[model samples]
Target: MSVISAIFVVLITILMPPAGVFAISGCSVDFFVNICLTLLGYLPGHIHAFYLEYVYYDRKEQNRLGRFAARPAPGVYSDRIQSGGQGYGTIVEDPLVQSEEGRAGATGQ
Candidate 1:
């Protein structure tokens, strides 16, 4: 999602928390939870929706951009990777894929 879309979602959240969460997360567990929260109280729904969004709006885009330049930590490892072109990005790995590859290499050896 883009910044403009994010802003729109935020505005929607302010007016109707559940609707905004539905827009962001779709009809998932979060949506059901938001519905319950909204039923219990308005504030809780708002809190949950905002927490869910948090500009985490574009994971795949950031991951795609992460392939390019980034300044790693000077020593050991930095939890974060900073890029001049964008803000920051972190690579998400699939453990299943890693394990499969590892097993294949070991069996071949």
Candidate 2:
């Protein structure tokens, strides 16, 4: 999250504790619960808010990394061009592949 958003959340929590907690949790829980928690103790509400933020950010980061890891590496193809073959076909030449091909051609391989 940006610093502005962090500051905004902190300010909201300090000014209107219950609303801040509710917003931080994406309103997944009852507003009354937040109100009760805030009423019980300001620190408890802040703690819950921080916990929710931690979980939210952690999950977001995990999802991003998961997506990145799920993608095929550059110059690698998902489908084989020839059926029943274990080798991958070169639809587009990677820089390494291009250089290797050039060397092979020069060597008459």
Candidate 3:
């Protein structure tokens, strides 16, 4: 995330805890739950916001590392070549023959 976004998230979490959690989670259930917690008390809302932040960062890091690990290395060719194999040959079928056969079958001949 950008520095601006990080600062915005921190500010929102501290000032408006429930909204921060909702923005991070983007889940209706989490949003409503955080709102309820905030209504009950500020501490609960802050705690939940921190938890959401931790989860978000954890998942983000995991995705970044996963993508890095999954990429092929430089100068690597991944395709495999078939050895001593005859390349593909076209098998042709006449459309006129197929149509005539269809007509004969339709006429019960």
Q: What is candidate 1's lDDT per residue for 5-66, written digit by digit as tens?
A: 77898999999998987776566676788888999999998887776665234332555665
The digit string of per-residue lDDT tens for model 3 on 82-106 reads 1101122744466799999999999
Order of the predicted models by lDDT, top scorer first:
1, 3, 2
Q: Candidate 1 has what TM-score?
A: 0.56
Compared to the true structure, candidate 3 yields what TM-score? 0.55
Clashes counted in candidate 1 amount to 0
Model 1 C-alpha lDDT versus the unseen true structure: 0.64
Better of 1 and 3 by TM-score: 1
Models 1 onward score TM values of: 0.56, 0.46, 0.55
Model number with the top TM-score? 1
Please give, for residues 67-92, the per-residue lDDT of candidate 2 as tens digits. Answer: 22333223212121011112235444
lDDT of 3: 0.59
Instruction: Tell me how many clashing residue pairs each candidate has.
Output: 0, 0, 0
